[model samples]
Target: MLHNKVEEVKSREDLIKFLLHLRKDLQTKGNAWENITLKDYLEAMEAWVEDMDGYYLNTNQPIPKQPSWKTIADILYAATMYE
Candidate 1:
């Protein structure tokens, strides 16, 4: 799942791979994606980042203390379809 892929992001190369995967996913499943427009995608990204710590705490995951490639990738990947 994409969640797994997002969790696996730890380096620049991984971020690049995740982005490529997102492109591929969009090409294959764009109909099912919610944030198709740039505006929606950016908004979702902002909202998701703002609430990311709460999500981690709620899910019993360690909250990221600093923004890293993984966190950035997670935000981008989530914004692709997150409501």
Candidate 2:
């Protein structure tokens, strides 16, 4: 999946480009390019937290709670598309 590639990205610019490409790919799959709202961003963050919790509970090893600086930059770049 594209998400797998995304997780492996270490460079900020590369991650931003990948995320933008991902959005376009989704659009090709019938996902609209509507403005992503704050609610949408929050929901995504919440889902990530839940995923981390589940992984921790199953493996007994905590997944990294803090994303890398590059990842945070990527998130901010993605947020620019929001309404």
Candidate 3:
């Protein structure tokens, strides 16, 4: 399932996982962590679903903008589905 690779997102663990990834990226690339706040991830997830090609094909149908954390969780989850 796409959601499985998102790690244990219990009690905001999702956000923590995101932060840890951000930290690692910083340490490796020496670039400041991109501000992937909950709001930003929500927007990115909407974009990912509406367009981007991953394991699933999201319809081009338009959906209301929302800041649901699952929006991104689903995208990250879906990407690893086929891996």
Which candidate achieves the best lDDT against the true structure? 1
lDDT of 1: 0.86
Predicted candidate 3 versus true structure: per-residue lDDT over 1-83, tens digit per residue: 21343544544677567656644654575333232355654565556666544323454534436634545555654332212
Candidate 2 stretches greater than 4 Å from native: 31-42, 56-62, 69-83
Lowest lDDT 10-mer window, candidate 3? 74-83
- Candidate lDDT (C-alpha), each: 0.86, 0.54, 0.47
What is candidate 3's CA lDDT for residue 56? 36
lDDT per residue as tens, model 1, 1-83: 67688888889999999988888888898888899998999999988988888878898988988889988887888798778
Model 2 quality (TM-score): 0.48
TM-score of each: 0.89, 0.48, 0.32
- The TM-score between candidate 1 and the true structure equals 0.89
Model 1 / residue 81 / CA error / Å: 2.4
Residue-by-residue lDDT tens digits, candidate 2, 1-83: 45455556678777777777666655674245333555776565555445545644675754556876445543443443333
Return the top candidate by TM-score: 1
Better candidate number, 2 or 3, judged by TM-score: 2
